[model samples]
Target: MSDSDLYATHTVENQPQVLLPYNLWSADRMLVHAVQQNHSDLPTSTLTDFGNIAGDQLMNAGELANKNKPHFQPFDRYGRRIDNVEFHPAYHELMGEAMTAQVHAYSWKNESTTGSHVIRAALLFMHSQADAGTTCPLTMTHAGVAALRNAPDLPRYWADKVISGEYDPRSIPASQKRGITLGMGMTEKQGGSDVRRNTTRADIQADGSYRITGHKFFFSAPMCDAHLILAQSTKGLSCFLLPRILEDGSLNHVRIQRLKDKLGDWSNASSEVEFQGATAHLVGEEGRGVPVIIDMVSLTRLDCMIGSTSLMRQALVQALHHTQHREAFGAKLIEQPLMKNVLADLTLEVAASLALTMRVARAVDLAKANQHEAHLSRIATAIGKYWICKRTPAFVNEAQECLGGIGYVEENILPRLYRQAPLNSIWEGSANVQCLDVLRALRKEPEAINALFVELQKAVGKNSAYDKHIENLKAAFDEQETLEIRSRLLVEQMALALQGALLLNADDKDMAEAFCLARLGKQQGLVFGTLPASVPFDEIIQRGKLEN
Candidate 1:
């Protein structure tokens, strides 16, 4: 055969074997290790199963679903105004797998487990490893639990159904579904993060359900049985639960304006919707919309941090896989000193991110029983949401560059991962918003600051580098005059200090030292692979191996 005839054979030889069965969390390392270190009783079997679904089944589904993105349907062929978002079979298949994994409602079902939130974080991190669109609704549902409690009647009403490990996508009332998914519509066009400026109005009705008449600029997963929305009332901004189907078995007056042409996250539907006196149930008090929804927003913000971290880990793993297999300069790529440095630093960066994020997750799991944990979770989520998400885009791009041309193409997941990276930082809330939230927490809730400091203080004496970073962060807090001007700077310092503290407390002394030197010690440059030459590169890189 001619050289061209060997195309298929040649392609096979160069392609790297993928790490599957959720190799990222197949072992109790990194984030999982951090979780087990604190919560020793987390079921080992559940972790293994989650790893299989994410690394194997979900990963396969992710590959196909992203290839076949969802489409918006304005009307049915019979001229019926059935606004629906049509996704490829693979997308639904992936959603089904994710729901079966109970990514949405598992934490609620396992509410008795002390490590429930950490387990949820692990599952969410693993599940989103493939596709993130479906994870959004699940996250909304999970978060909805916290906000749902405000409406005392909602618990018995939604508890069993929301906690059901089933993915019923029927456009029917929540009562009729085998299981139900949840969504949220908060931001409108005029106000992206400034939800207080939302002009949507809600009028009380005789039947107890309010009539919401306005538009939501961005409504995710429109097919969800219900969405918790925000609108203006006589009492000011309030939260309302808007269902797709009203009690009379008729579609609510939710007129789909159009679907958003988002930059990435193609597997889910984000729509612009108009409610013409739509039937909605009031969720908390009349004017407590922002305060009520803040619970849900905080959870989604945590999801954003997890999502960004997942993207970075995937990119790093893919880079590691390619470097280990592909060859150049008469040697294997992994053997190349330059590439090894980059991978090792990436490994440390991702590990530190996972540690800090999981620390928040642990606090979340323990929060219901302990107010201190809750306060720590509140502040940790804000700091992580800002720093980790902001770092994702650059980290993904660096990982992509490691693969050169191949990573830039659609054939590999890097391009898709890169495109998906920015959405997390932008989603739920933007970086600036999170930084300000950190500032707000410090200003209004001194308890939260103390909570955060308590957590950071855990690693204070372990390492001078980490302790110094914490001191720097404390000094920034003291400078209230320039706090706003240096808000981002201060948040960055706080986040880094927190991550540094977590690493310093971690069992992996080498990885911790490397992280402090590269990140906190200022011994590295702006880009990856800038770890100091004296650092032990082999142990760090090997620890990052997907198989390990």
Candidate 2:
């Protein structure tokens, strides 16, 4: 079949219309194009490595570049054309933890880095296939836990693939390279942030499977081969691994009713999926999916942080390039003090964000290595997710402003970054949810808080920037006397402290400290802003000092 015909075959209009528009072809093209662009910067050796692992035909940069040129006809609802791109089946084999590390590093570079998502999707897809005993190189932390609970030998299977790189998912003819997408199903028609009120239900079947029946208000890649679905199991609110395609390799009973007209990540599909007796395999166990998924969710949260950092970095680079050459008022924009400060601030914050994210990634790696501190790693992940998710959008917005009107145009990547950054915090878990989790984790084991503080103290002792920030944080903590106030202050301090520890561990101690300093300064402003003017500044200072 011709490329056009193949693309046309994937359109949703041709399929039985479910609740949301099902356009796998468009989504596929977007993902393919993004992945193609992602590999553009790689050397031939790396490309060959990817091809060797994937065992499928890998498109080189030249072919990908040719395919990525915007075409008007195959545009999605968002007006973004699908870039015709293809990846070798071995892409999954090539994307192991090291690749994740590389992608994470790239995210630190700038906002235009589209490789993170590609790597992420590849990892998750590989993860699913690996879990099913199909050969794939990628490994996940929760996979072991799930294996212990369900499939005991699964970890060994994963280890062999990772160590030898000899496994091929396509080798199992019955198990093809299936497309996978990750999305949160927390939102409901009634409440979004309040997931406790979610009404999705799962009824048990005689065959030991589940008949999941509920409406997912916002589902990403609903038509993908597999989904990490959230549902209310018999135990409580939980998550399940729901395959879009059944064991018979047919589309499940779930219906995709509508595709959301989102502002950014336009190439990716976000749909409202309605499950009508959809069959699902319970991941982990009953009442255990929430925490289990939360662990997995941390990976995505870290991705969001890194993705935003990458986008901001790209925006800053582009802005700098444009400002350096484009003269305004007979002087380059970078020559002006105001523009120079903006540039400096953008550069600094982007660096800080990158440093913070990498720290989290390293912590995640450490947790995986030592397995004993998995909980601590989860907390660190939350901190990373919360801090970066909150800052990325602001950084993107500020970076866009530096470009003035040009940044708002779709032609420039800033607007897309800006639109996509917010979804990072909202997905995986919102900022508030992360903060609450931090609070809950602290409450569960107060020693974790002290341990975190000690880690920060050690980091501070080594680095001057961190030392200064810690002093400020100590002062802020000392000021709050009420238990309620102390807990809140500690939560904020914990975030800063963890950020410092991660950065220190990641070998970027200075940038992490600077970010904590910025955060401390901002928090002070917020505290001062809310205080009564009649109150003495000294009293406020005194209270802050007391907490430390």
Cand. 2 TM to true fold: 0.64
lDDT of 2 by residue, 288-323 (tens): 666666555666666556555555654565566566
| TM-score, predicted candidate 1 vs. hidden true structure | 0.96
Least accurate 10 contiguous residues by lDDT in model 2:
128-137
| Steric clash count of candidate 1 | 3
TM-scores for all predictions = 0.96, 0.64
lDDT of 2 at 401: 75
lDDT value, candidate 2, whole model: 0.49
Cα lDDT for residue 264, model 2? Answer: 54
Model 1 residue 175 CA deviation (Å) reads 1.1
After TM-score superposition, the amount by which residue 319's alpha carbon in candidate 1 deviates from its true location, in angstroms, is: 0.7
How displaced is residue 374 in candidate 2, in Å?
3.6
Taking the tens digit of each residue's C-alpha lDDT, what string does model 1 give over 1-548?
87688665544566567544545466535656777766778776777777876777777778888777777777889888877888887777777777787788777888887878778888888878788777888899889877878887554657578788888877777788888878899989999889889999999888676899999999998988889999999999999888887657788899988888888888888899999989888888989998899888878888888888888888888898888888888888889888888989999889888888888888887887899999998899999999999999999998998889888999878988988999988888888888889889888999999998888888877877777788877777776888888888888888898888887777888988988887888999988889999888999987777655
Off by over 4 Å in 2: 1-186, 191-193, 369-376, 462-468, 472-548
